[model samples]
Target: MSTLYTETHIGSMQLKNRFIRSATWENMATEDGHMTEKLYAIYKELAQGEVGLIITGYANIVAEEKPNAGMMGMYDDSFIEEYKQLTELVHRNGAQIAMQLAYGGTKTTYNVGERVIFAPSEVCERGTKTLGKAMTIAEIDYIVQAFAKASLRAKQSGFDGVEIHGAHSYLINQFLSPYYNQRDDQYGGSLENRLRFLVEIYTETRKLVGDDYPILVKLTACDFFEGGLTFAETRVICKKLAAIGVDAIIISGNIHGKANDMIGESFEGHTIQPQGYFHQYGDVISREVNIPVITVGGLTDIDAIETIAANTNIQYFALSRPLLSEPDLVKRWQNGDRAQALCETCSKCRTKRGNFCIVNKQRKATIAGF
Candidate 1:
């Protein structure tokens, strides 16, 4: 029997099982960053589907720098009530939920020309091909406080935890990347300097949320390209986070600036991404740190998950695309079917209306004679 169905703890939070619903960009929120009913429906399904933990899509921390359209916002107190409803809904269904907070920085062009966007340095963002204004020390201080206040809001709104989005080539990841952070100041020269921004954010966030609340960080194990954040530097960052009292760490990363390449199998059917691509990093970091470690990177297959759990110190496995295709995947496994997930990892689930399984949709349509 697999041990994945057993209970686990991340700090004080007791989860029902080892399955975590990794955060994905739903693009289902309102333009102003409020959680919409669509998002609520999505979370509700996952909660009821028996996911032990759910990390909501990255909520934009600053109002002026929402890097993507339809992102949830946590810039002020206004977000509390709606989120309270969300947390209560998840809790009612017997699952724990955490809010993932982020600042998109130069990774997007959502409002690039109209407003000022922050970056570690004035490097051109490869994804959007846009430039950002290098932030001053005062601006950096403002953002640190923004993260702290957002954490407070998350706690007050009844979330079980908060995960800082320190990966995905976002603002924090940019600071940690030498390719992006060319600044010679205190925030940028060596690995220690590059780590300063994330450390400060964690310090301020911890102060507000208190020591008991679970504060997790999702970090890029490597930037997977030349001159970017390397795995060697990532190890040091994970160790520092553990020493400084982070409750848990989730290991993730980007490959050549393509998010899909990190997880999805080649759609052209020529190249295939190995399952659990990030597991090696998680295994190394988990052994090196004393805290809980969660790994996310196209993880599927019950047997493989069971094997990983049996052999490694990695405490949790997170899934995104598979869960999109089968929200009740955990329940399905629990019931003893134990087959691999139905998701093909084709990356077609992503759409403007929020991610839904295109394969499932087509199957249902065909069955209904549509």
Candidate 2:
């Protein structure tokens, strides 16, 4: 009987509605990873627009793990006050926010200056040709501790929770995928070994944050590639995470390299297709886990949202491009406009300048009679 606008709780964090703003890479922070006024304004706007929950852009857990310029950082203690200010602003505007802690692994570029890239095993990553060195046992232990410390910082900063980014073929996802994780050590080989990294991370984080503080995870339901993490494997992973008291699971998939399968591309004959491109995988995973499952990717239509809420036990709907196009999308739907989002999903927001949606800007200008 729950609806999109109904209030819900992900562990102890109570949200006003079921709509969540998925974690996106907003290239808006300083090179050293300080929060900026422009970044603060984006979350304030989303808060004022009435989105239920907002997960911030990926915040690197360590300096060497950063994926791009302007990616936010939690690697240092200095960044805590800035994030506290951000959380205060968003909370004052009546929205809940979570910081997504991540490590880029081999998916990063060296333009940020040369740093050794760490991976499950030393392997040549596709497209980049850069050979990632296998992470030593000490390095692996360090990364795990880093995740726990970052989660502690998120709590100290007054964020409602922290999301461990284990999706999109990042360092955590790389560990989960057999295609990338070929190590025979305790951190690889068997599925349990591969998942040990995440399990240790969650365990350590929970120990620091305690039982009441929410600790959610953004996980890939599938890598959608041959020899990659599959839906079946994902189910087992989800169950284990649930058993360890993961507050919720935000179901997502793949990395940017597999854009077609990861984000779903527009075809020649279709201007509009089904909403919630990853719902099928999410549905399967949702049934496997007892925790709330939030599904993201290609969820643009209001009708589709209502139908999914009515038919499935899925607890939350997360929108990325749609919120970029209309930050007040949930408000508009509640007001009964019920129109599908205008985002073409061209993903121009993924540009180097920042995560600004040019199509949304143009639409706004048009509405203003420009």
Candidate 3:
């Protein structure tokens, strides 16, 4: 009934309002994968601009399993103090922040010094041309510990919350969808069995962060591939998630190549090739689930943004391009001074891997033209 800007609660975390700077893979970090000055400044602006909560770009929990060399990682505690500075900046700007803990399932292109890629049950991520090693039960246990350990480190780093990157057909996504995973073990087979990895991640993560700290996940509204995690199934999954003690869920989807490949982009087909296009799926999940939800996919229109809020039934409005376009957007909007501009949809924002926004500058554009 109320608009998105109305303040809301996501688990124990109190948002100043309901506008979320969605977790985008801002390639703005060190090659070794750490947030640098530009990364800090870009987010700091959003914080000052009055964004409700910020779910930062994916930060890998381990190194060799990195899908790409550009992914930021929290692989070691040595980096925690460094991350502390970034979180402190966000807090000073008046926003709470959550670090997206990630691990590339079979999509990892970073082979620098490793040769093994493990999935809950290796069917090799749908349409991919290559194959990764199947995760042995013992290996699966280690991976779960990696997530839990990373979450504990996140808490120690002073982040407000930890969000498991289960959407986009990543590690957890593959296991959730029957299309990618093919095993007869307890970790596979039925829907309940398929979701074991996520349940494990959530259960252990809860132990790591405690009841006071918020824990969330970004899961697909649908895989958009045959027999993947469809909206219908997502509804069922959400119920199970509630029992597992998940705090919030970010509604997201994956773009597959011509077939349902989890990692690589298809030359042509419905894989989110076009930009700013993923709210319908989010709404589907929001309607079926009772917990707070955040949705994103090429979102960058005031009317479109308002439509997502006005007629929709979700708790938050999320954006990757818009924030990359202008960090101060919410601040300007709140002061009755925001404008509309196409995100260029260049997607150069996600392409550069570890460079600052090459497409848009911050605070320079007057929020007066939309």
Instruction: Give candidate 1 regions above 4 Å deviation.
Output: 256-273, 362-370
Top lDDT model: 1
lDDT of 3 at 204: 85
Candidate 1 overall Cα lDDT vs. reference?
A: 0.87
| Per-residue alpha-carbon lDDT of candidate 1 for residues 269-324, written as tens digits (9 for 90 to 100) | 21223666677778889999999999887677988888888888899999998988
Q: Write model 2 residue lDDT over 1-370, tens digit each, in one string.
A: 4377888899999999999999988888998889887788889888987999999999999876677889899997898899999999999999999999998887766563477778888765654655677999999899999999999999999999999999877889989999899999898889999999999999999999999999999898777667888778888999999998999998875645244443444322111125776676777678888899998877888888888877777889999888878888788888888888888777876776777677765434212111
Per-residue error for 288 in candidate 2, Å, reads 1.8
Question: What TM-score does each of the candidates earn?
Answer: 0.93, 0.93, 0.87
Which of the two candidates, 2 or 3, achieves a greater lDDT against the reference? Answer: 2
Candidate 3 residue lDDT tens string, 1-370: 3375676788888998878888867666677788676677777777887888898888888766667655678888887998899889889878999999987777554562266777766465654434667788888888899999999999999899999988876788888888888879998888889888889888888887898889988887678766666667777898788666788888766762221223234312323323235455556666766787676666655656776677667678777666777777777677766467435555555454442345665346432221
Clashing pairs in 1: none
Candidate 3 vs. truth: CA RMSD? Answer: 5.0
The better-scoring model by lDDT among 1 and 3 is: 1
Q: For model 3, what is the error of residue 174's alpha carbon versus the real structure, in angstroms, after optimal superposition?
A: 0.5
lDDT of 3 at 51: 88
